[model samples]
Target: MEGVPGSSSEHECDSNSLHSEESKLRLKDAIKHLEQLLLENDLVAPESSGTISHEAMQIGQDLYKSTVEILGSKMFVETEELIMAESDDEEGQFEEIQDDDDSEQYMLPEKDKSMEYIPLDYKIKVVNMAKEHPKWTLKTLHKQGCSRLKSMKHLYRWEEDIKHGGTIIDKYSIINSWTYDRFVEARVNYQQVTTRNLQEWALSAASQFENFPFKASKPWVIKFKKQNRIKQRKITKYVTEKETATLEEILAAADIFRKQTQVLIPNFHKDFIINTDQTGCQYQSTFNRTLSTQRAKAVFVQHKSSNKISHSYTAQYAMTMSGKLLPLVFICLQEATGAFGSKVKKAVDEFVKIYQNVKVTSSKSGKLTTYLYTQFLKEVLSPYVKHEKFLLLIDSWGGQTNPALYDDIFQDDNNVGTCTIKVIPPKCTPLCQPCDVYFYRQVKNLIKRLQNCSFLIEQKREIASREDCIKIHAIVHHQLSAPIFENMLRYAWFASKLTDEREVFMNVNEVCFPLDILKKSCDCKNVTFIRCAHCRANYCFACFYDKYHPSTCTVPSTSTDE
Candidate 1:
């Protein structure tokens, strides 16, 4: 009232009322502006789009950045139960983890009885039955008198069940697929009993169901919900230390491997290796058809856990190359070997090719072949090693070793310089090998790719039938034979890999590779990196003369065309 110079008590009331009206008009303008923003955003409009509000966009950007900060590096999200495992005591870990998941009831009356749970031998019986019939049903599984899931309390004790016709390859694949911690996860993570998804009616070859007991034979998905939801994430903080190769190395390797896998097409490697080795690609006048497509005879899966790695060897001779650094040949081999009625001699040749050795006192040809992979170490890896000094990693298997493989690779009549073959400390391979850290990446992608094919088939058929095997094999060959996947494998293995795998071995982990270029490194840290030739996967030993690579992998690709 004092500020209104011309106003007395009556006039002051009118002036104050006008001021309040002006304030109400400003508030109405503000509300109109907000409503306009909501309309632009289309949050309330059915036919509107491309109208994100500035405030809303900012919020979304913040969420995306947070996700990248936490989960961006990995292709797969770690199930939360694995993260929460620290809170559980050892004794409580073994309690039934999935009692609520399966609707099926345990029928065995003596399941928990001590006497019936004795571990027994069953390999011969199991092998014979599988070899004889190629597939099994619940009736056949029951004939073996193997302990049902009700009979055993621990998963490890089921090894005997695998021996008899009680368990089949699918179960073995499932068991071997997970790390020990994952086995504990299988036991603890869900409401349902974790069974092999392959044998269940989930996959494509359902009508041809092998009706096998749940066993770990190959890798399969373990689907469980943490707090009951499919947790989507982008950023992951993995525990990092210099114990072994980090998961980054493995993923990068797989990325390289996935890209470089044109080896599935075939190679001049047989002829090149023949020249390199001064011998034919055959032993005893037998030409090996196994390597027709570029592939490893056996994958050295150095299963590292708690500062130790158990070198679990799986053969993939009949398998085709899906990748080099991260393993892809395993699943393919399991499928192909099961199909086409694969043979044992071909399998053994694959074993012999991986490990090299001199003859020993054996009546069987006076020599038994062993995997002393010193040759690849000597010829290909030697010149690229660090400081003229390098580390050789191997498992604690009692097979012929490659100590000599590393030490004196270059032979001379005059004088041989010193060399070193430093095997990584036992059980430390997972920490040391780059492959372990990154396998799940491309491995899952590859599985997802294969799963896509399986799902596309007619509903009348699924996996493990004579027809499904052929169809899946054809699909696998087509996907792998594609140039994109093959180039990734080649780029990752030959290009992305480091001269020394050690993290401290010249800051190797920091040496990252994009899909475009991989800057290679060697000891003295000399670098030599390669790029794609027109971004195509096919490689020719003779650049100009030969139009196509070796005709072996290119064998008309009837499957791809089909």
Candidate 2:
């Protein structure tokens, strides 16, 4: 009896091993449910119609399509037969439903929206399982769902997908990744295999550190399983600070003069006013071997130093949120100088070349030509920005943001959604250079640190666009010490704990002002700071300074009033 019990357990284990894949389980579940449904309706059980539908062959076809899609036709043969059988079974049941003259006068699909379009392979799997699982009873069906995903990785990915749409046929599945694809290499642009024996016969090992304390290549660590290992590898070519002339470097250091100008000037809102400025991170990278080093501390130091590029061009938009001048929106961009609309059809085509040829991360630069400056606000940032009075803080260099651009972007009539922008008034920086004060110092530190680390290079060769390079930085950035990375995000955003309590913005007009602001700022106190001479609304002091009034409007009268 004891031996018999053990033998039964073995049989059960064997059964499960044979049908562990998700497709197989789904098929089993479908058939079990069908049988129950038929019993409830008191329908005659087809002696031959095992769990599949013969009446609606189309349903079976659909299942076959799903099966071929989920498991692949080449990989899942048995799944195909089950789907075909279900199609035949559906045919009979469907006919009976159609024969009922008193039935509801509408044709209905087999499944509702809750039950969605499954790929061909998955559909086939369900069909086959049902065909084979006649005697198997479904004790319960527990559909596990999830929400409130907090991982920064997931949040960023969702935002990126929303902005770019997708490659080839546009489907919402890419937008909706309910089924997570955690493939190790899905996001990486390039990879290389290794020859180490310990690495070869890999077993998952307890990491000496929970997070790698440095920024470097992905394969962040060689996460080896008992039989396999995973290591993140990053390959960014470090820009060696080759003996830059201290005087020239001081000249290269754009932040110094901006700071001095800020203190000398009062109302000191921000610094470095340019007629126009470039966007996007300044320092970019390519492949590097610096990461292959086994020491954790060394990698961390190397990464912190060399990545001295800024995240975006500082566009100063004085936003009226609660009557406050908030510096918002870092317009990081790639110059559109090389792209012409008539020659190429899309902004994407112009960007595609840079995607491969240059380091494509949010932070970038390789021999700075024209200083790029456009906020790289993708899906993640857009919605939040759209919600509040979103403003971009930048130097005066970015040609005054066109009023038409503002009208086109911020007005509901334009359907550009809705936003508020106020270009920070020119000649203010000591107290309010969004990132100028905080971010510059941080990048300078990182640049200096990486400069000292010994770089392991295959050889000195420059390549444009290195997506893999950025991937590595992101991975290492995650592993590095918290103080370091938080600073990185801060520098990227050009935000600080401090912003002016009172800034002059051209209050947006809804019928007169945006609804959210209507509630938030008391409609700019019903008494606005500056009024537009051209329009009825309050003059967005910052915006008018940049776009509408730069060339023609009267200069802002200086007043010490808070």
Candidate 3:
């Protein structure tokens, strides 16, 4: 009786174990199928998500339930071990697949690969080979010596594409998405966009990131523009400043200014009536056009001081209705503490001794200030006026518009009597300001030409320092003060509608650099390089730069005196 009970119980236990193994096998097959689905759809969740998809969750639940049923008594320890082992294997495979997918994401597309572009001549040759031996396979071509022949299928495709007159189709898309985003933002903000700008931006983006398929080439620019539907249009107009009011308002203000100054003009002498303005002058001026070969698409000039072009200083000029420039020019240089250092002050003192007409000062912002304006009045205008009752025309700059600011300078000095100040109407400088209409443009053009001549003749690349600016201004002031420039100054008053008479005048270039002067000899008896505007004499580079003429022209009988 005992042997029968033991035998029956053992039979029941064997049946249970067999059933558990079958269920485990089914669960594993289901898991395999789910893995296949996930792989095909690229649905492998990253470990950082800390969760899985619904299908994966179902698989986990079924797996856990089955393990619990199979090993009921020891389910805790063994089930944990089993699930860990299975997950370890699956995670290893999944991670490998993920790594492969990441690398594929970075790989350049087929059309962007440089190898895809074949020469037209080579394509024609390949087509000719095909025509000669229609039955020969690409393998046969390789055997018969076709250079760069790798894929037979690709060779056949190329011949067909060539027959259809299709191009080789190698092109590029934007590799750095950040660059594209930034480019669109810039365009939306009305920034000027160019192919070179795009190339530079792409290169910069590539430097900061990894695996960016950047191509800073013309072809890439062409393709990118086409892909984005961008077109190059000629810029019809550029807006320098926002309009303050409607057209009628500007005209009315200008008219009011003309009428207000009409009476005072009769009382003041042409030589006594003065217009003063301050303009920003760059340390280094660059030329827009240069001599270049006809075949060249781009022209470049060598400039070692190119980096300093952005820095600027202020220059104040005064002109009279009789077309005469004042003898002195006030220059405000950029300094850190609103003053110059001891060494620079000494140099400036020395410089002023040579060019006695130039007045040099400093401000932290390099702009005209109340104190500097007073200094200019005391140092420059007071000495030259000589007890003249004059009318002063100036723009409505905050520092100059205040009438009380001029009290101390003229009150203490008898030479400069009580003067009248006339402010140009707001927002009408371009229409009613004398300096804006004529003088500033002429001065700037002359400065640019002189700078260019200095570079081309002497191979000088130094930026105009504070002393250099003072010298240049002195030379320019002396040149414009000539009797020849009288008509030019008169034209400025006429252009501003301050005077009814229109005067005919030639510009600085026409007056200074005549063709006749080009063939003359310099003061040093060398071939003429430039006409000295200050001395009205031709000078070679050696005489001008080496001897420091005009700037240091203090001798009695030489080209130094006016």
RMSD (Å) per prediction: 28.2, 25.1, 28.7
Best by TM-score: 3
* TM-scores for candidates 1 onward, in order: 0.25, 0.24, 0.54
- Which regions of candidate 3 fall more than 4 Å away from where they truly are? 1-243, 294-299, 412-417, 454-458, 523-525, 532-536, 545-548, 551-562
lDDT of each: 0.28, 0.29, 0.63
lDDT of candidate 2 over 353-429, digit per residue (tens)? 43321222122322122222223233223433453333344454444345454444343434654433334333322
Q: Model 1 segments beyond 4 Å from truth?
A: 1-402, 405-422, 444-448, 455-562
* Candidate 3 lDDT, 416-519, residue by residue in tens: 44678899976677667888766887887777766777435465555377777887787778777766578778877876768866533445865667555666
What clash count does candidate 3 reach? 1
Clashes in model 3: which pairs?
A: 387-415
lDDT of 1: 0.28
- lDDT preference between candidates 2 and 3, better one: 3
Q: Report how far off residue 367 is in candidate 2 (Å).
A: 12
The order by descending TM-score is: 3, 1, 2
